[model samples]
Target: MMIVALMASVSACASTYRVPREEAPPEWREDGKPTGFMPIEGSAKSFPGNHKERGVIMEFAVENERTAIITNTLEWTGPFGGSNIIPAGSPAYARQFSLRMSSNYGSYFGKDMNAYNNPIEWCVPRFDKGDAVCIFWEGSDRARYIDTSGGTPLNASPTSPSGMVGPMPQVQEQAVDFGHQMKIQVIVDTFRSNRITVATRISEGDDWSSLGRTKVMFDEGDTVTLKRFDGEFKLTAHRAGNGEITDVDVEVIKEPKAGRLQTFKDVLEMFMALKAAEAAKAAEDTDESDTASSPEED
Candidate 1:
């Protein structure tokens, strides 16, 4: 029945919109898809040459109307409430593919994905009556969907039309436990490159122990001068390291001119930055209050 709904909802070919590297990402970018897993489709276009994850192999096992199983770790059921056509020529995993991509994944990673892959993958999937399909790759972030119902009973992972709606889940960060204090190193190779590396060391007694490091190559430029890592995330200042994070520690000598080696001086830098931001916000509030009470300009 749900498959029938999909067949009924067809649209013109999608138009492609490539993200310019020089441009800035939109604010309030969505983090992870609010809907946990992305619904899998029958078959995906193979740009295996792109050399990212080909997507883990999964299945669709119908259990109840509300549940389905793919593996011991993966399961699904019921139907995604929304069912609408995704715009055509949507970039697969590119920074601009989804507004939230930048918030957690960073603009650099998105650009790296778009560089070699199709600028946009056709998002519209047509289904015939009784056409059951294989699951979409759960690991793929390119699965930005607003509606999954084509009047069918297919399981869907739906997203808000305006991206994330409602409050975003707060990052529950547990402070990175590394003895006393810790130091973070950010290395940037800025010469028409799209890779960002995160490395950290923790003070142990008197020596600095390497925690772990991770380097993500993006689809574009690095807009982050100094950012707290949060999906692929929350390497925030000196707060906490996400359990899901498995970055290795990196050790690199400083390079002059090209990029600056940003070091977080414990947590003082973060505290001061927060204070500055608060002061700025307070100033703006004062200005707004003054303007509101003043007479309107002609």
Candidate 2:
């Protein structure tokens, strides 16, 4: 019947050129490599306006694999402006994000990159992966990267190339509570010379103690004070040598009733009532010097 209708039209064009083999690709994928929740794709050539209500850019291609660890989760709504992209309960909402890694053969852009100018969207890390393997997010043009889970696991198996690797220096732990002797203020806005180390702990329960240690040497608008004896506290500020700490936190409450101790007790009761009227005029000049040396007083 005409060769079985040309063999059923070449088996329906080889079943439409079969294509079903993509379920082992997740060593790190983002920057428009989406297959599901699709929201990334050239992102309108990098946010082309409507005053940019949303924008997205995600790229993670750790090929010869050097290091490109990524984990991102975001949620947004409401009036949040910029100094560098703020909107999570503004006030310069700082949580953290500034992890950069680039390598076309390395020239720059990898020194444990976490250059926090004003980053705080979530834990963002880019452990320098130089040479080829990539992960890059060029400054927030209204930034956006909706989903990426965990790290390391995408296979093709052809391994043998690892060179540049840098990025592992983060120690942040802050716990503060003031309820007694209370006088805690630590405002450090550094620009240079900054070595602030203030530690305290008083939680009392099965063992949790150490309420002492203060070290300060900040520059810009520096203000440091610590006087505790009233509960929970822990503060740490670092950066005095290898420079790289933009700011630190700590602002406790309640301890404002001194007013110079009621203005020094109203100037010590007006100088003790003017020294008791000059001791009553020196006791009437000692009875007029004992009647002008006696005699003459007769």
Candidate 3:
């Protein structure tokens, strides 16, 4: 009865951005049951190009599968010590060094059912296997980071005037979900008065990169973040006495990119269906319990 709810939820949203089809439905899951994933076999691979060239391009169509795997977030390890590129913090551009957001950091194609085109150009910080991206719809090298602790509908409105979605909760370095396998781990190894050493590793191999150390000097008890270190996660730190600093927080950051885009009518509808499905399941359970414990009339 409650076998594949996640699959149903995603399929509902896909219809909003999904491509119409006349062919037979593709296989769902190995157990002949529906699941919220399509199979993806790829990694965040880089070809050629330096920091400003992007060396990578990413886009996906929800019409392709039930669970959409997309990449809208990009991350870089040390990337040759440090990157000159960072988020512009104005929403006008992705990074201070990039002019790609000409009022459209990302855009939608077609009229009826739209397809998402996220920016992955001039976005690759390193080609030495030190850069990565994350799944938004059609996943890139990895799957996703879903917060299961909260029951908030995925469509819950944010307080932002731009009407962006809610915030993405923070997950530990190597946190893994059921179907979404986290492929990157960014860690802070040494924290001193004036500098911090960072290490980033991918899940597929035993090697780790040393491209992410920060040499910025900070005073004790001062809290700060770096615009240059901004990506899918923010590197936040607090300095301690004697330079033997310890506590460092890496928070997830997500600011939606849009261009010629309107409301997510289809996704909202699907969210409603998901909520309804849960309610139905609860009602069914209650009815069964009532029937089983009912006292027979004399």
Highest TM-score model number: 3
TM-score of candidate 2 against the unseen true structure:
0.15
| Full-model lDDT for every candidate | 0.25, 0.25, 0.26
Tens digits of per-residue lDDT, candidate 3, 101-199, equal 112332122121211222111111122333322211212222121112111111111111111111121221111222213233334555565555543
Candidate 1 deviant stretches above 4 angstroms: 1-266
User: Residue 228's C-alpha lDDT in candidate 2?
Assistant: 30
Assess candidate 3 and give its TM-score to the true structure. 0.22
RMSD of each: 22.6, 29.5, 22.3
Residue 150 in model 2: lDDT: 20
Off by over 4 Å in 2: 1-94, 97-119, 123-298
Q: Count the backbone clashes (under 3 Å) in each candidate.
A: 40, 8, 11
Models ranked on TM-score: 3, 1, 2
User: lDDT, candidate 1, residue 246?
Assistant: 26
lDDT of 1 by residue, 1-298 (tens): 1111011122233212222333222211223312111211322111111111211111121111111122112122223333332222211111112222232454444323233222211122123321122222111232222333311212221222222111111112221211122122222212113343433332212333232343443322222222332102211111124322222122212211111112223233444654576567668968988999999879
- What TM-score goes with each of the models? 0.15, 0.15, 0.22
Q: What is candidate 2's CA lDDT for residue 61?
A: 12
> Backbone clash tally for model 3?
11
